[model samples]
Target: MTIAEQYEYWQDVRKGLSRRSVLRAGVFGAAAVAAGPMLLGRPAYADTPGSAVVPFGRHLAFGNDPATQMRVGWQVPSAVANPVLRVGTSPTDLSQTVQAEIRNLRSDYGTGAPLEQYYGHAALDKLSPDTTYYYAVGHEGLEAASGPVNSFTTGPAGSGSGLKPFTFTAMGDQGASAQAALENAQITAQNPVFHLLAGDICYADPNGQGKLTDSYNPAVWDGYLKQIEPVAQSVPWMVATGNHDMEAWYSPNGYGGHAKRLDLPTNGPANCPSVYAFTYGNVAVLSLDANDVSYEIPANKDYSGGAQTSWLERTLADLRAKPTIDFIIVFFHHCAYAVTTSHVSDGGVREKWAPLFDKYNVDLVINGHNHMYERTDPIRGGKPTRTAGVGDTVSPVTDGTTYIVAGGGGASLYSLPSNGPESYAGNVKDASGVAAGYFGAGGKVTEAVDWSRVRYRGHNLLAVDVKPAAPGGTATLTVRGISVEGAKAGTEIDRITITRTASTVDTPAFGSGALLTGAALAAGAGYAGYAAWRKHRSGLDVPAS
Candidate 1:
């Protein structure tokens, strides 16, 4: 469509969707004019009011703390006047109001197709812990439909507060597709407290590589957000960075678009804002940026200047030292130990970060990149500490970390090398089966390891039930893999139990030095330096999927 036609349609949208907000938007004329045309802002009569645009992609995230703070985010087709949020203890009386921050992101990929979108963000502060609150979005004369007044409950206040039980779901590679919508419905059915997107969130970049030759269509993000709103509108939808998320057309590192679309926590490392941590009840969750160290896709390798790894070590130490935090769940985009035929395990991940997980005795390490559901036995030092299977319970402090690859979040399915059904302890028809060789460390190793406990070629997501224990009780984490499509839709493909002492400190089987010894630390440091030097010399520019 021509520019004039586009403007006319947007104006028609305003007239048909919200007449009151448009009539009241004359006051914003001077402000829009002051913002200049590059931001796509204009005088009252020329621009469509944000309130009239009908906000879509409503989602939530934590504001540093999950108990008393929340960050509400949404998208608008155009700018509006003082976008605000009204929230309160009950939906009927949303008397408390807070002004929302507007991020005006304009996309022009040198293809003569320019698109502008306004993202609204609001951080709710000083909320009561363990309390449920209802909220609505819009500004001045406009308001979201009152029928669906969304509500969310805060987590427990502090550590060891006898927190109530909660459930959270996770998945990855959720591009806009019908299969993804089914998984989303299944996720909403679970009514989880929060959710995690491992990575490759929306394939707007298409290439899935951080390269300059990739084609980008920022409008695709609009559809992606609307698709996930069924569940994300209420649950805190936390996300990580994947290789497909990079947009080189925006900046040198190609994350300029990511920074605008999602308002993540700024409390992570100085170089990597996407990598952050937050605690809910007895669990401490950490989100990482695997693109910086992913070997399979080195398009944007070592982008974080080694600061991410250093910060991770310190964060793990701090969480493990706290007695209130029982479980440490680290999630990223790349697989540390996956046995899938497509995009096998990433060796750089294991070489750099797996040892840190072992040192802190992390309970669970979740990943997404393989596009399937797979689990590994409790592993330590490149080997399985115990053979875990269905109906089996394992202790992280005694055995090792459990790695789970739940990449089937709305994307196409990938099969194992064997092209067989899932392999469980009870259903292991052959012990000599080799699913696939791991990639990383400069070569592929064809070692037939038995750590592959369960592998299912289906679209699935992980639902983790965290049952907090009392002062002297046993706390347990129950994980269930739910299939979202095919004949096994809604069936549990895999389940496992992780038990920990309620109020005791965890004693890592491997001492601190045993994992990241002086020699290993030196090697890691040397590798980081070498990566930075190579990046500077190569001057490579690539886009993320």
Candidate 2:
């Protein structure tokens, strides 16, 4: 249809959609007036006597937290912490009536930038885990809908018996477009128990949806409510940031990603702010800041180098303290290993972060940066292994940690890297970039590659098959990838199953010899992988469908 025809079509659709927030938007007139390249503010509208509670807009809504605690989150007009929270049930389903509310106590989402506290969340304690409950944020008198708009399930109490596999979706770096939105909506349609992201929520290009909704919108957000609504409604959406969702959005220095737009459990480890960790069954999950560490541009610094790194180190240490925690999974926005010929493995990530993971016995590290689906072959120190299939790798006793770069949620496609200096588009480097390489444990970016396999540009999804330890034993963690089209039925191109020994799962036990033994084993096997590598061996190490 012609531009006018399309506009008319959407205009008619908007009539049925909810109206824009009645809140008064910021003054963009002055900024828009003298623009060389115009910058737009969120939808402008006069505050129609707004209520005390932040109104729940379509883009940003709460996700279900899988536990006895409800993860209540909402994107507000500004960074206001005045959202008085409370929970109540619709009379129709008042099976059990229990409610409570709490403020952020200290509500500045990790980014100390001058933000309007775009998102705020509270992990309502004392609720039943695995049980669905109707919840509301803000004041009780205001329109019940004005408060947090949705509800979610708390994490299963503590991993024990009688638990089933819970599903969560993972997507990121989706460039702003109806197609990207539609694909994401499709994945959400799976009705996953939860959804995890590796960052770059929206490419947020110059005319990006992020610009249209302010950074305040992240889910069913924007003009595509139909896409994210169903999934966000039933499942809790979990996330971490990527280069696409840079830490610079609200920055002079750098902003913390602790926005309320994405409903993350503020009750996570550390003063995590935007970064947090939680337990699901036998797994202990750790999500951190990758964007901060990669920011070496003139305008940015390596965020992961300083405080974030310290937090990471401490957090991993803390999770290890938990006894029931069978598997430890770490996720972030940047990929330590890149395969889109356009990008080289983040040697910096290998050198800097690999040691920590090795030391902690972190089973799987999931991230998105390259818009593709690729899994590393049980890496440690940055090296790839020969095989991590069902056999060679132990299922649960001493499985090595695996890393995955899953950045293809539905973003502007990143082409496979042709012969070149590895997707030179945005890798942060100084005159000594390739020379200095990536940082290892001590802020060193040396090329100590000993991690796993990786790919670039494949829009893929992840499926983690977590099987309980052979009853009283350590649990077996299996990870697989699914394409956007075939994801509903669940297809696998690459799969890795790692085993964590009983000793390794128990906290404060200084992870058993599993990490070291497995790493050494995989490292030994990796030599075969190296020999089999395209340039070296007769056969390549590509995954077979």
Candidate 3:
């Protein structure tokens, strides 16, 4: 049967496959009968390899991905021999020839499981953005779910204008290693193009009490693994390191990196493994590291000038040079601006980069050091509203930028600031610094920015979408919070409609840069003359593997 067929069949009898089909399918067929497990889920890697443990307690998220690129992740055993991961375009067939690879990098840092524990990660690249493909990991055909049959899609490069709408999920603090990671992964199974782990991913704290026991181990109870099975099985799961994730260790592996290991897309941002960037439609996303081992400052100072800064400057310059790159977003473990007593806007994010951000005009900033979700309307140099104080009329800051501290991703809950919302922020800075010449140089203050919002508390996920302006229309930015008030329900915490009569063919190719490559890639990539097709909102389907 085709993958779609398998998906359809599973959808039909997925719940009863175990009770009804197990006896009918015989051994291998009985294993296929795991449609129940397929729909419901699995046992953890903690059990002996393939011990009929039924990895349960997990949920499928970000699965059946629909982007041109997709990332599949899941955990297996340290003892499970010849663990080969294979992927393809359907539930029934899994072929490596479909354009995929496998890796078995281990980790010594984590929570829940004991020491010497290892987790598995495989990052698939060069996929057709915005298309769905099925995958699984294991020896060709065994007597069960080698791992799982999941689906995913790469983020769409965009519509006719190389513009695509993308979605990413947020979660944090997987303190229990594979289990916690898995639990969050289960939630991430929603097939987000990627994820935002506010803090404490992998929980591989080499110095922590449980680091040696459970957090670093593979899976003591499979609960989380099963939970995250869906997300890990598909979609790129991005992480923001908290204090707990930075566990130093002596790895027999080359560079002697930290205790934890991540499988990132080597296909992206040449030579930059952990820190990289990608584009989805008009949004350019840059992911960076913020922890000590990542930054390597024993002083444990925050956001010091590091490789990340250099990369950010260069990346932002490149992005600004191209106007087709409508929006800019930066994600790191520590918040550039935070009201949480637990953390604050580090100098690195403030002094070093915020200026460059102002110079380049960054769109939105997302961070997760604090375990809460807060949204800033738009502010330059910390605090909200450029007016320099609260009670300012809400006027969208065209020159300034918006900030979001969305850290709540189902690990643990956090409290509000001691000073409350209005007071949680530092006294407003030079408002005109937000609006070009408004703030005079001589250590002066001018112009006042309006319209900045902030929110804190609750375990939640952020849903962001990138849509183009109407035919000859203006740019609009929309952000939605899927959970708040203790995961109550999704709410529209922030929304803004930006109008700009700026450059339309603002991309480097069409502008002054390599016009030839731009035109050629545009024509060949199926986006040439795409502006005509821009009137419609539906995304153009593309190939992916």
Candidate 4:
């Protein structure tokens, strides 16, 4: 069938139409199913009845509030009875039991039996701030506490001087490869509080065009999850949707699969599952759904009807207005400024959200799509504000937004310009080695200027160390690109420091006039008091792990 015909058939399937009705409409026939398994959902591995229902793909994600809430998600081979999660301060004493919410997904592309997968999510709310919690997942036949236990540390108090330093890792286009597995181990060694998967997760849909003709294997998610479970089970594996994530058969918007498989924050505009915001320490991170605004792959473009962008601008403004949030980092799939030969940049992202990023002085923008590690010089108003070389310090408040394409997350590397001198940590290239590439609508327009700074074509992930400072001090985020391949595996190939004032609010005077000092001290004391009150209201303290 043609792409349009296949799309129509998938649409019918998405609408819950009966197979007879679909046949009556001549959407497909037995010949189509007989053509190949690619057109039909492949058979899932059989799990004998009475066998163990081991949970795999166990991952964690923060709720709207990272300080006191967490969502644990996992997958089982087949449907299980009474699936639940148990949490406690110690691995041996998981006393708090919560029933898991099961989301079952079925994919039937052709005439074969539909592929069925079961996912479970348990929300752990009102957790104590900065405390470690150990948890396990199980069903009726399995013992939750007896199973493998994973622990995660909650974020520090969201407000007041209690803010603590933290580390996080990010990368995209991570498929289930040996390189990806190696990267996961590298990420675990960083001891990040969370990990941002910029998108193209698992590449279940190889075509990634959101067309029915795209080859998809729902089981890829199974292996992919198990691959990252070592790290994801502890660190929040925050994810953004990429073009490959759009599975048309699942839902009208092609996110039903994701909705069922992953439990993400729902604080963004309604129906946009992947767009949300969370804060840890002094930095606020926004995860955007780039598929909604991707011009290169217009399959799911404008799916949110501008609501996503509107919410994004509002969220950015709100985050920027908060004195506690010193840095705002936005991450999505398609790149706004990349100079790769493949899928260089998305005009839609630049057109829709780049200005808002600049308007809010977004400290850093991380993207994935082109399968390589590329960073741009600090940019503002569609031009490079300054050339930010590797190991250089950049203040987004003054320099501009620094964009990094950390797509080398376990996926095969894409080609960098062979003729040009690519710059990276330990190697800085001058403008004399300018390379030409095309980027824009459909990534077809050719324009070759120089904003691409560091380019490394290897399996790598970003390790970011965030330091919180007092009201009048400077907070810093040190980003390092750690390669996962070759002799320099686990070595830093790129590094940049982003710094900003700790807060917009002024520090209280210590010993001024009696009246002025009294007022200032009272105000400072009131803020701290409020923070303590809020913490008390959230939950009682749990012993640190």
Candidate 5:
């Protein structure tokens, strides 16, 4: 089935499942499923040369410093003896050995299928910055041959110093599918130094709202990791949490499963893996858990007790204050500004965080959850600024932050309203000036937004190139939306260049010039051009608190 149809099907199935699905314990209830023979004991794999336990789901992540700290994660089917990773500069000589920590997760609380999963992780520290290292993972009896050792080079240390140019990929809502695999391969082709999954990474949970009744399968995560291993094993795969990530059976906030499977930077709040920040080259990448303040998905709202928001304030301030960090890119799940009907813009995000983005002059805000590719013009104070549209360059310092809904990361494709043709080439803006539906403020709003820059209904991802400014020169960030599937695969559907000067922050007056009048907006003139597409306000149900 198509992704949109699949989403609707899952929505219906979740409704049916919710009627009977009840959590016996929180997300950390590993005991919810009685320990079976496999759960309590290790499985014996034949010791033959090829019979050794095969390691799958090999992926990479980084600590606060990408140059010095690296994290290698993998999975084994069952308990293994002395799981560990060996690394060195040469593939033949793995001189350094680090023991792996196994985190086991048992899933049987609500879903009929009960199973146990083991995630192995190893953290390599004190490494040289900007150096390449080869690595292999295995235990006593079973090891993948040393002939093809996986390897990744560390990024340059900190920001500010003259560093080589670098690129990174960003997307969200990547589930297990051939389309997702295609996107993965295309991303690897881009040769990005790191990749950011804004959120909704691997939709293992059928009911994506993170509600108590959602059904989650822990095994799907295994498939997802293996699915992306081709690229993830080489590039640093950074992830944020989405509504679907909240597995209700695992822990109170439904992130127990995530805690067990992945190891992220510890710079943020105590146990929130979904929220953190890291800087590489000239850019500071910040990942946020939109579920904490998602109007689109309120299941885990405020799960961080205001700490995440408070922390974001401090982090944004620091990034803005740092001389080396020329650009700040914040990524999360729900869109702060989107022009789709399926899951439109989230007002809660705008209410709580958009101001901070404006306050700090954030360069870009990337998000997912809409299952399509879309972008907004430079925005501040809840509307589009003078600078917006394709090929139109704007400095966030004077205009505002540009928001991208790069949700087309291999889930189903969501279509734009029938009011305008899909944007591409020179057709950057909606021809009919239709006010796309936006989900926020505990309801939906149809506003004729001049900020709708590029909207494409396709499966794609965003690759950003960060070029640090030289002394007395300006820095530039180039963002590309690449089509990864269907007839238009490999086409550059959207592109934008943002320039920044050496000055850290530049504040400008709000609502500068020819702004959409409040009267025209209130009279719904924004919806006039496409009256056929303007449906009455519906499907804006306030989620159960």
Candidate 6:
């Protein structure tokens, strides 16, 4: 069928009407009559060879325990009988079979017909740490081992001598475009243990305001998943939530579709699926839902009733107390400290979570929504502590937290404020006075600042190499911002090293009025309390999935 005819047919389906009804009403002329048989039940594309259900958009995610558990998720064109996953250490020797869970989603938000999608997830548990496993998805008619196979390496063991070096990539605002495809290829070349997508996964909802009036096309997700499947099938594509991800048709919170598509850790709050925590080796990663704390887009702000924030604080405290955890990284959608022209900064995120991050001494915070790559100097108490030029090293324990705006994953680039010469690594353009804004009530509040260190208006992604250290030693995280621009493609736009003591006892820089009881301190204190507590407590090294 023609594109116009297919669109009309889907519209009729979405409206609970069939093409036959539209034909009887004489809506179409000769073209509708020519495509009537194909539009009656299924589209022409649905007829595959042997009528076998083909799966696409295959992706992988880590469960609560990255060391021993992994979740594989994929989408099928149609519902198939007994979807299953086959796994083994060798592709030739497929030995394990796991049942898959189906999550079918239906949406009828636009004028077109309602759309229904089928997704399958299989949770593999009790796997060995640091092992490479091959897996494939299939159903009854199609043998699982007969399909194209992919492999993923489980994370290193959490404690003891098992701590090892690893690499991970992060980016956000990645839509299905050539730039996005380039960044994905770059990430695959890095061979990261996992990829942290800071939200804005796909531009399914172009108008990111969480409104019913926004153009919503669920098909965009299909192309996006297919585009990223080459990399995501091997590397766990860990994701957070962005404003564009808030589709009003999904659910009350607009994350029901996310829950159906991505199989993230459920250790967060009861209702908030986007907010979760996971740990790999010495690094603890927390994914937050920025829409709940965004002032600029208040459509879904404060929807979690403070539960997400409370969980974040508790999770931070817990991770900080573990001697095995050397770094704590938080990633979300809105920027807490960025100087881009599009969406400068989110005051709600700063007001709500900055203090908590300060108290816990978060190592690094990654954000998107600005559509550019901007980094800040080490910040504490809402101000830059020191100048962190590219290639410079900063100690998070003393200097403060570093914020990176890596919104250059895909989509159209947003221009940086034309205050000074274009600044980046190696070539520095120091801006004496840079005008910026913080989004809040009554729109943005313009201001001036000097913390906008490195700004690159192009497509980029963050490749971080983490080197673990023995107890009482020092660990380092080497962060590199790789540019995907035309001529400067694969060049480094920014680089920094975050060094911290591996397993030392350090006191948190608690803000004023932050009181902690003895029990609370014992439960949520630094490594000192955990070291003392470890003498009496012993259990599984990794959390259960």
**Model 6 worst lDDT window (10 residues):** 536-545
Query: Candidate 6 vs. truth: CA RMSD?
Result: 8.4
Candidate number with greatest lDDT: 6
Q: Taking the tens digit of each residue's C-alpha lDDT, what string does model 2 give over 116-224? A: 3234355556666666666555533354444444555556665544556655556666655655655554466455666777676654333221221234332223333
Q: What is the TM-score of each candidate against the true structure?
A: 0.82, 0.65, 0.64, 0.86, 0.82, 0.85
Local accuracy of candidate 5 as per-residue lDDT tens digits, 185-263: 7797788999999888998886786644456566789899999998888899999988778765455566767887898
How much is 370 displaced in model 2, in angstroms? 0.5
Q: lDDT rank, highest first?
A: 6, 4, 1, 5, 2, 3
- Local lDDT at 137 for model 4: 90
Candidate 3, residues 491-520, lDDT tens digits: the string is 444333332322345343332344333323
- Cα lDDT listed for each candidate: 0.75, 0.48, 0.45, 0.79, 0.74, 0.80
Positional deviation of residue 216's Cα in model 2 after best superposition, in angstroms: 13
lDDT of 3 at 300: 30
Provide the clash count, candidate 2: 57
Candidate 6 local lDDT, residue 415: 80
Of 4 and 6, the candidate ranking higher by lDDT: 6
Candidate 1 lDDT trough over 10 residues, lowest sum: 536-545
Query: With candidate 1 superimposed using the best TM-score fit, by how many Å does residue 210's alpha carbon deviate from the native?
Result: 0.7
lDDT of 1 by residue, 463-517 (tens): 9999888745678899998887687788888899998866532222123322233
Candidate closest to the true structure, highest TM-score: 4
Q: At residue 7, what lDDT does model 3 achieve?
A: 36
lDDT, residue 138, candidate 2 = 50
